[model samples]
Target: MQELPGVGLVERARAVAPLIAREADEIERSRRLTPSVVAVLIENGLYRALLPQSLGGAEAPIETFMQMLEEIAKADASTAWCLGQCSVCAMIAAWLDPDTAQEIFNVAPGILAWGAIAHEARSVEGGYRVTARWDFASGSRQASWLGAHVRIVEADGTPRKNADGSPEVRTILFPVASATLHDVWQAIGLAGTGTDSYEVADLFIPERFTAFRDVPAALREPGPLYRIGTGATFSLGFAAVSLGVARATLDAAIALARAKHPSLAGTAMRDNQAVQGLIGRTEGDLRAAGAYLYATAHTMWRDLCATGEFSAAHRSAVRLAATWTIHQSAKVVDAAYHMAGATAVFRSQPFERRFRDMHAIAQQIQARDTHYEDVGKAILAGG
Candidate 1:
């Protein structure tokens, strides 16, 4: 399928937007993306967008990948959320042993996904015996491999510490089949993400399959993308997804306003000065937020390319921009949903689903108001 591609990654993503949109109902019903939709994503190279070139991935620029995510998200937030999870997990390949990384990511149909929770792993001969039930394992149904972040401990239950006195934590890798998945993703938003819980019982993860996530010194791929760190990449990708969801909801509202007429209004909603003003103002807000996010991301990337290092200031700026973008995006979605009136209350329409999804994105830690405090602290410290 990769060989038949005439258009680039971004073009392919744009072309599949309709298919993704068409699958939203099925995705919502199944609590996971269907096989057909997953096929479209894999065929389009969306899952491999963030992987390094050395590992048979596109190694596309971060901005390009973010745009692709935004495009997918505009069609379906769940699919975009799952794609973001897989793509971000793939970034770990840049830090894994070259041979191990290649074998894991170069499968016939590439797959990678992981949960964010840290489990417990006991240090043992040649590896660690890990045990934990991880929640929010997005894309697990479609993933070939899964990971668990674990804190290393002695067999006697004492925590292992590095020379600097920091608790030793490592991300352990295993096949999806090795873990048990529990159907717990009963959320109002992103219901199709299949973000269920997975458990592994005393599984032995060889040292080679585990690595420190977001550690720049251990990276095997020297691209500037990895240098920006995993956390920042997540902030950027999810922010893009939030923005995309916002744009789609706003567009749906505009379409409804232009066509639907209220009982009291003689003209269509578009003719209503209040509705006109809402659309105009919301459009400006989304655009400005998007611009801020993209500009901040580009600046960070450029700094990485120029100096081979992303300073503390760059990281702080990314956090700030992503948090601001997500909050603003939620506002835009709220405005659009409210303006859509009774039409938005129906489950069949696009506005309702996007309204739930945008709020869910806002509730995530990346969008927390405390992120503003973190950035403020960084600035005060002269980052």
Candidate 2:
């Protein structure tokens, strides 16, 4: 099938869902995506969804990207999480020089992943020298390149500051071979993501390989998608992933309710009024949360495309919607898991894995309760 920018990506994702579902167990067992799953994702151009078109990417609309992730997530949350992490990382190409961007991301399987901001780079002639370790690099196992977000410090250890007097942070890019990978990703869920730690000791990165991420003045690409920024894109994509997980879990519960009968009770679960009521309420909650997330993303995307601007209000709206959707999705999964009773605790059932994945997603930084506080402060301050 021919793929066009921002077109039919959701269908492509759905087409691949069954394969992803089949590989889900192997993925968790290996703590990384299977080669088959990775090939399908790359072959379908899913990883390039957020990359600029100039770099041979889809440059898809944000809503389209979210929908695509939602579909993949219904099959496997880990696959969706890895895809979301790497796809958002591709936005850095927009802030980089054309030659540099092409050199880094134009190659086959051009995937990059990074961890949380940590440590600092000491300034040197023509580049900066970094000797720092970063953690939580989801999808790093499959990435050809890895990046580090660090504050810049001068030779004598003085900090480099922007004109506004804030300390400067830049994302430094390097080949994955330059870093020492650590196998420390043991977790309660989302094990397939390979969200591990990596370290680079006294490594030198050329100035050309660094980017001032999320800073408008440093952007080299003029696409509206980049205006949404990586952080916000991640929030939007992961929210959709949560929705997918919740949807699947609830569906599994409904199926169980229809077929399952209590040992002592005379009626099937579907005949229980309490089970019927819970299913109705949970389905409504899931659908409503998904609608709110998609509507908020579409509104921001429309205004951005027309005006070439992404307002602070737009960012706040996305943050609120994404965080709330994740929390609500978790609640849906919890209800569904409980509704499944003893079956949910067994590894053989669908509810067990999704229940764990939903909680893990909720525990992530994107789903933090502090986002609500941030949005509240922004509203009260009239932002």
Candidate 3:
């Protein structure tokens, strides 16, 4: 292990604890991170942790990213969601040309926001004319730019052929100035994430600023961080969201339960067997989910750094593991709400908000159906 320098990540998060918690409700109400909260994140330099050191970032170990994610999520899941996407994208920036990366990190290390995950882009003159509507662009309300996806298209609209005569697909980074951020994220939970959609009409993107290739995790790029797997980024980021929500829900429930008494009897809430059972089960579930996620994340990172790549089978396994971890975390959070009785359901308490947010997170593509199918196929082929 390399010796890290300067203040620790844990310390950085501690410095912002009051800030993230202070505006969490406002974030939930407005469906976006508050300016104060963003400032705290920037000042702490959390986003800089993922970018390569050469680009004026810490390029900290992947383990640090995973653990820090859990801590941030615990404070505010929506803010963490916005934080997750930005920081995870920083890893991609680390892999980019130093010049192109400077255009992003040099201005402000942890303040850039992006949404170019899915391969929805194509090539054009000088660069690529991207034409696709990216969905669930988390934190879009405050985004300065977007890393969107595009598929190659002929001027007549038919898909174009690549060098091998196959359909060409690429991720075109469309600046926020050229795209429209649609406020479609209204929901019962995770409203603060500002997970809106964006549309681009004949947006021209230059090639120098884009990364058009297979998934980063699938790439054999000489850099160790780039070879983990194409989809692990989604898994890690979403799993961190789950851990955060579960932690928040559990904390809320405990606080309320400790203060209240069981309604039908003279017993205190904490003294009731039923309440104890709920707490026990919820805590166990949360611990298991956190443990599994951290373990798998560390393994993936270590393997990548040492081997420069991991097998496709191992990568798929990690994704499956991470997805299941999210599901488990949700179950634990729901149980926490049950332990808190009707009090947890009231809008006044954080429990209801966290519950809604967690359920919403579970429905994300990273946490839902598609991955189940992917894992099933990988299993049948022999894991």
**Top lDDT: which candidate number?**
2
Ten contiguous residues minimizing lDDT sum, candidate 2: 1-10
User: How do the predictions measure up, each by TM-score?
Assistant: 0.96, 0.98, 0.90
lDDT of 2 by residue, 158-215 (tens): 9999999999999999999999999999988898999999999989999999999999
Q: Which residue pairs show collisions in model 3?
A: 116-147, 120-149, 120-150, 121-149, 121-150, 121-151, 124-128, 217-229
Q: List lDDT for all candidates, in order.
A: 0.88, 0.95, 0.72
Please identify which of the two predictions, 2 or 3, would achieve the higher lDDT against the true structure.
2
Overall local distance difference test of candidate 1: 0.88
How do the residues 1-383 of candidate 1 rate in per-residue lDDT, one tens digit apiece? Answer: 56322237778889999998898999999989988899999887889888887777887778888898899999999999999989999989998988988777888466888888576899888888987898878889899899988899998989999789989888888988898889999998999999888999979888899998887877888888888877888899999999999999999999898889998878888899989998999999999999999999998888888999988888889999999999999999999999988889999887889999998889887898999888888778877
- The best candidate by TM-score is 2
**Residue 161 in candidate 1, Cα distance off native in Å:** 1.7
When sorted by TM-score, best at the front, the candidate numbers are 2, 1, 3
Off by over 4 Å in 2: 1-3
lDDT of 3 by residue, 1-383 (tens): 75372237767875686689889889988889998887778777776666666666666665676667778888888887887777666666644566776776676433445554454344456876665676777766655667665566765667877678877665555457788778898787888988888888767777776664345532323555546533576577678778877888888888877888766778888777888788887888888888887888787777777776666765776788788988998898888887777787687777888888889888877887788898899789876
TM-score of 2: 0.98
